[model samples]
Target: MEESIPTCTAFAGHKKIAAGPVVEVAGKVKRYQDKNPDAQILIFDDSSSQQVELDLRGTVADVLSRIPGNQDPDQEKSGPGRPRLGVVSREIGLLPRHWDWLALQPGGASVTLRKLVEEARKQNRSKDAMRQSQNAAYKFMSAMAGDLPHFEEATRAFFAKNRSLFETLTAGWPKDIRDHALKVGELAFHDDKSANP
Candidate 1:
């Protein structure tokens, strides 16, 4: 299993101050806060574009310790069954017919379920990514650029998949906000030939 680090971005007022793994961003934010205590700072998770509050009351190492998943994975004790694979057991319900079908699969129910899930994920990957990007952009825009010019129109163009119009509308926004919006929303405008009209 590959380790995935959580990434975040911090903004001081409308200008982005830091972006990268949460630990790094937290360090930057700590220093920024130390120098400018009165400045407004907002931190957002890169994946969800949701605002995250960090405890900036202590030393950099203390701040990092409070962050979830900051522990060294190697130092953590492993639990039962294939810890290296990062598999967790969970109960799932299925109809009798579904169970019967899965039972007949060569690797049994667990393996068959995993294969089916992986196949579906592969098939839906592009659409999933596009939706996630749109959501992330919308969340960030609504929070940071709500009062910016043409925000409403830009939002409409965004959902309508009108990249050109969205770009034009957001062009007048603060440089950092506009750039971050465009970067996160890039995949939302993917030209998938099979996309519905």
Candidate 2:
């Protein structure tokens, strides 16, 4: 399950139950749960390196289809007058000045708006990513480390990117939980830094 490329990793308690594609990861969870009915499993998305929850109650096919790469084939076929850039026509209400400003741009209003949106997304990508990662890690730590020592400080240190302090605070935690907290917290900090820097 360990690949050089990033992939989702799932753990049932301290044991890694699955790691790879969503389908493969889901399958592994199924198998693991089949043997250990009471085991708690947590999933982590590789890109954000944050915990992700999978509803294993669904069929394998259903789960696979939800993954990004497993989109339905029919959805790829373009209809007449429909651009293939996955753009959907939607009406946007803009003030007269806004419309005028957009019209002055080289491209039409739609193109200008699209460019603006893209630029904003690029500008906020790191902040948004870090926020998501931090939230995910915080959710996990809150659930698992509520009873552990220095929980609040650890959380603050987590957002502050004080990795050494975070590690020290979590040192008394269980090995598996401690390691995961550090991993996800570090990821959030790194993402935030990369975004802001």
Candidate 3:
């Protein structure tokens, strides 16, 4: 008797276990998982019979950001929308000052966390540092588009469609992700509105 793992089934989410161009599938699911937790995705290639499993833990925005060519997923042919995923970062609270120090860092991501923390802690709270910290915080803040009309629109749609779910799921957002999640809501509002109206 021979047992077989289901070929086109995605576990723990709606993502189907199928295959396509590995890179594209990876890119798609990367964004898919970033936006939802209970949502699953499906990617299948009939030729090679490859499959992928994606558990969206957050908005697909982060994945879109990393895709190089297309930074704006909202403008693309975003296929059927699935429940957004929830992504959790293990890092500690990062204030504006921390962000400033990180900005000055050449390659903070690759550096050892201990070393990075030590360097950040070593910087004194002088007037110069304070000014620099303010600048850095502003830089990080600028990364998010508050006035983008699209942002407001997408959030409105999501709010109208998934009011209860969004509230319950978003309520548990960790300290580090609260602001980002809010921004995602803003973008989603823009997207949803554009789609329907």
Candidate 4:
């Protein structure tokens, strides 16, 4: 997936405390921690739903400055080649036949490889997006709602693409958890009309 500004959500116990850009979320979490020192706080990346740890010591600016990916763009180190174009060189292992085919293409190996990758990404965009959304939703659900009632059935329904059944099974869950799950999982059920028709 293409990199974007990191968005995240923070939960204090079962209630969502804050959400938005990572720095903003971290600031809110820090304030909440100041009020309720004993409260368990979990911050999750909105895109990946993976738990994140933040250094909450010191002032809000201090905390925000400590978060990863919060660096100033001007301070970013430029690598060799075209950094402005966002190109990075990486090694790939391809068989001789594949190399031969790439060599025969109009733009040589790198250009041909980039074109092929772009085509494949375009073709699989919907399916890829759906899978990513499902995975993110599952990660969040497993972390927050694992012990809740109908957890197993809800998971099954989620993966099975039975949106109605999934909603039904999660109806009794905490409002925050249910709402967030649906929000993150929304794209998982997106029907590609062109592909389906």
Per-candidate TM equals: 0.82, 0.66, 0.18, 0.84
Work out candidate 2's RMSD over C-alphas.
5.2
Alpha carbon lDDT of residue 62, candidate 2? Answer: 66
Give the lDDT of residue 76 in candidate 3. Answer: 48
Model 4 C-alpha lDDT per residue in residues 44-112, reported as the tens digit of each score: 888789998898999888998877657777777787756668788777899999999999999899899
lDDT of 2 by residue, 85-174 (tens): 556776779899998888899978878888989899778877876776687678778766788889999889988888788888888878
CA shift of 48, model 2, Å: 5.4
- For residue 112, model 2's alpha carbon misses the true position, in angstroms, by 1.4
Query: Model 1, range 22-73, lDDT digits (tens) per residue?
Result: 8899999999999999999999898789998999988888888877667777
Candidate 1, residue 24: lDDT: 94
lDDT of each: 0.88, 0.73, 0.39, 0.87
- For model 4, what is the alpha-carbon lDDT of residue 31? 90
Candidate 2 has a TM-score of 0.66
Q: Which stretches of candidate 3 lie over 4 Å from their true place?
A: 1-20, 53-197
Worst 10 residues of 4 by lDDT: 188-197
**Stronger candidate by lDDT (1 vs 4):** 1
lDDT of 4 at 140: 98
Judge candidate 4 at residue 122 and give its lDDT.
84
